[model samples]
Each structure stands twice: as C-alpha cells, then as structure tokens.
Target: MRVVTFCDIDESVIDSKHTIENFQSGCSGEAQIAILDINSIFDFEENKHEACADKFTTIAIVEDDSDYDAFKNFGIDAWIKADDFSDINELINLIEKRLFS
Candidate 1:
C-alpha cells in the first residue's frame, strides 16, 4: 500500500516525518508512505494543480470545516481530524481501515 499525506507547510515537515516513522514500524503489513505539503503543489495564485492531484492519495488533516471543499475538490481519500484523534496510532488505524476495509 502507498499512503500519501497532504498537509500544511509546518505540519507537513514535522507531522509527516513522525507519521512516516510510525507507519514504517507500525503498519501491520507491507506499505510505503510518503508525505507532501499542499504549499509544495499550490501557490497562492493557483489554489489547485493537477500535478499534486494526480500524484497522491491525499489525506487532509483538517481542524475545521474551512478546507473541506478544497480537499474534496482535490479528490482526497479521507480527512482525519487532528484534534479529535488521540495520536498517530489512531490515525494509522483510520488510514488502514479506509484503505483495506
């Protein structure tokens, strides 16, 4: 399985690294995970781009309702609420369920 995470710049660097490490050690079966920042794909002038859209199984870490449409428009597989989840383990579980189940 290939897991691609799309997040903001700050979260992209920190959270993505953490998730990658966890997923590498903890994911039950064979899987490869990669992370990309939304900013890396989109500039302020261009809110959306096909390169990012085509290259990822985008998982948006949403805190509120603001970016829901944007992520959905980008064809994200799932939206994991940051505050609602306890930790990366839970997040991994969510991702596993979505992808495998």
Candidate 2:
C-alpha cells in the first residue's frame, strides 16, 4: 500500500524536514510513502495538481483536536498524533490495518 503523510508546516513538533524524512524512512521497501505539507495543498498555485482520487488511504498528522474535523472531512483514513506514537512501526501497523482490512 502507498502511504502519504499530510502535515502542517506551522506545527512546532513536525517541521517540513522531519515530516518528509519520517515518511521516507518509515516506508522503506515495496510500500511507498510521500509527505506533503498541508499549506502546499491549500495553496492552489503551489499544488497545481490534485492527488490521485483513487488513492484512498491517507494519514494526516494533526497537532490538535480542532484540526480533526477538517482532516476527516477530507477523507483521510487516519489522523495520527506525532507526539503520541512511540515509533513509526505503530503508525505503519495502523496503516496496514486500514488499507488491508
């Protein structure tokens, strides 16, 4: 399964570099992961093209409860708290379950 991480650049704990690197390192083999900044998506000029509509599984890293409604409304499969998970493996497991099950 392909995993994509959508994160807010303004968030203190999850910066652009960390978000990109974490997604890259987390999805190492056959499965692929891409990290995209939420600002890019919101900016039409920056994100000229839309993500593939058929690629359904997406995980958004949210900093607070307020962001949950918007992310969920966008059809994200899951919302993960960056500070909560002990490791990437736990996040991967959630992805696996959502995508495969």
Local distance difference test, per candidate?
Answer: 0.42, 0.43
List TM-score per model, in order. Answer: 0.43, 0.47
lDDT of 1: 0.42
Give per-residue CA lDDT, model 2, range 1-29, as digits (tens).
Answer: 44334333333333233323232224322
Which candidate's lDDT is highest?
2
**Residue 98 lDDT (model 2):** 66
Worst 10 residues of 2 by lDDT: 44-53
* Superposed model 2: Cα runs more than 4 Å off: 1-56
Candidate 1 on 24-52: residue-level lDDT in tens? Answer: 23332222333333433243114223222
lDDT of 2: 0.43
